[model samples]
Target: MGVAYSVGEVDHLYTFFVQWSPNIYRKRNNKSSSEKDMATKKTVSNSKASKKWEIITVKDSKRRLSLCSSVDSEAEEYQEEDDALPVLSDHSQLLDDHHLLKLAAHMPPRTRGYRWHLVYSTAIHGSSLKTLYRNMAGLDSPVLLVIKDVQKKVFGAFSSDPFKVSKYCYGTGETFLFSFNPDFQQYRWSGENSYFVSGNLESLQIGGGGDGFALWLDADLYHGASFSCPTFKNAPLSTHEDFIIQDVEVWTVQS
Candidate 1:
């Protein structure tokens, strides 16, 4: 028999986005029908993930994507394998889809050329933000938070630190915000890294740790206060043009 698994694996793992889709995960979240309906309504009104995020899967060396969260899909688990095995996959085309998740054509100089590497995505094996945070906690890498407002304006922040739940902090001022305005076909990033974190952070009921990184678009900036990083000294998230976050994603930067 041919080797059960073993193909091309990246010599390096980079920062990547794990596209989380709320639509595909509710089925297994153990919510009542009515609760799910309410959640569905809330998600629809606030998130575009179901409509935009493509379904992703972690695969084996045979190029078979796993429907389960088995160890084979985890690159980190494969690091112990013998040498010269790059871990090839027939799913290489799927790799290109990372482009759709790009926050900007170019990352800030401070970012030092980091990319969003897929890790704990919601579309796979019922993963969600709760899972994302749990998986991300150990890595402690910088993260890029992307939010799509109800107005269709896509913007985000690059936090110098990984996300964590807190009632009182969002990290140091090593963060900045960016906007991807399709209407203007322009990308905008704030000028400095003065943004920080402040306020109550709850674990997400569906996914994630509900840490301060969580977004409640409807709440006032400082009240929900997951983030304190404002582009300007006075322009808190509440006053930003895209104040209402319809959907959100967190990408861990590898380098």
Candidate 2:
């Protein structure tokens, strides 16, 4: 026969069982429960980190796009600005026809003896013909004389020195006459606006024994002029019948 345990011993055993049960349960749950908790925490942290990274990437991308857009806009604006201005060639094309026609009218009338004529005119405000002549004195075949007529209200000689005559002529008036020897070999040119008339004085070159002489006339003397190598009879002591003119060439230097 076996003896039964006392009540105190039984109570103690039940208490120990209760405590042991909890320890065993804790040991069993530790592997999966602790791992699950760690996974959840890692997931939450990773999610937060990923969201932060995405925000940064998005902001950086937007910033870069904005910068690229601004640059493109600036370039377009510059192109538009450039397009709005007139080109140099276009401005030249738009010159006043009246001015050109007037210059054409100033051309010395065609004569039987003259070969060619080139004419130019410029306002006195910018450059002086005399200065231009001085600059062009060393070029090949320079103008023999440059007649200057200052149409301005001022009355003063353009140049008083006679030595300066070799290059240019200056005067205070409305019209001036220029005579040039095409035979010159060296002339250096300067200035902006001028008129040139070129023709061969074939008869003038022959020297004497001609029906008429070449004459340069200022028709309006004050505002306009005409040059012609007219044919006239050759007679002694006659003001009009002295020499004949022929064959002129006018050209600009390219060098």
Best by lDDT: 1
Query: lDDT tens digits, residues 1-255, model 1?
Result: 654433333212111111254444454454577788998899887676567766655444335433344555565445533221222222222222332334333444454445455544323413244554565667766766655555655555566667655554455445555545542122232344322543223332111122323233222221122233223232223234325444455666666
- lDDT digits (tens) for residues 1-29 of candidate 2: 99899999998887787587977756666
Regions of model 2 farther than 4 Å from truth: 1-128, 141-222, 231-251
Candidate 2 similarity to native, TM-score = 0.18
Evaluate model 2: give its lDDT. 0.31
lDDT on C-alpha atoms for all candidate structures: 0.43, 0.31
Error of 1 at 164 (Å): 0.3
Please name the candidate that would achieve the greatest TM-score relative to the true structure: 1
Clashes counted in candidate 2 amount to 28
- lDDT of model 2, residue 180: 18
**What residue runs in model 1 are displaced by over 4 Å at the alpha carbon?**
1-110, 119-129, 183-195, 198-246
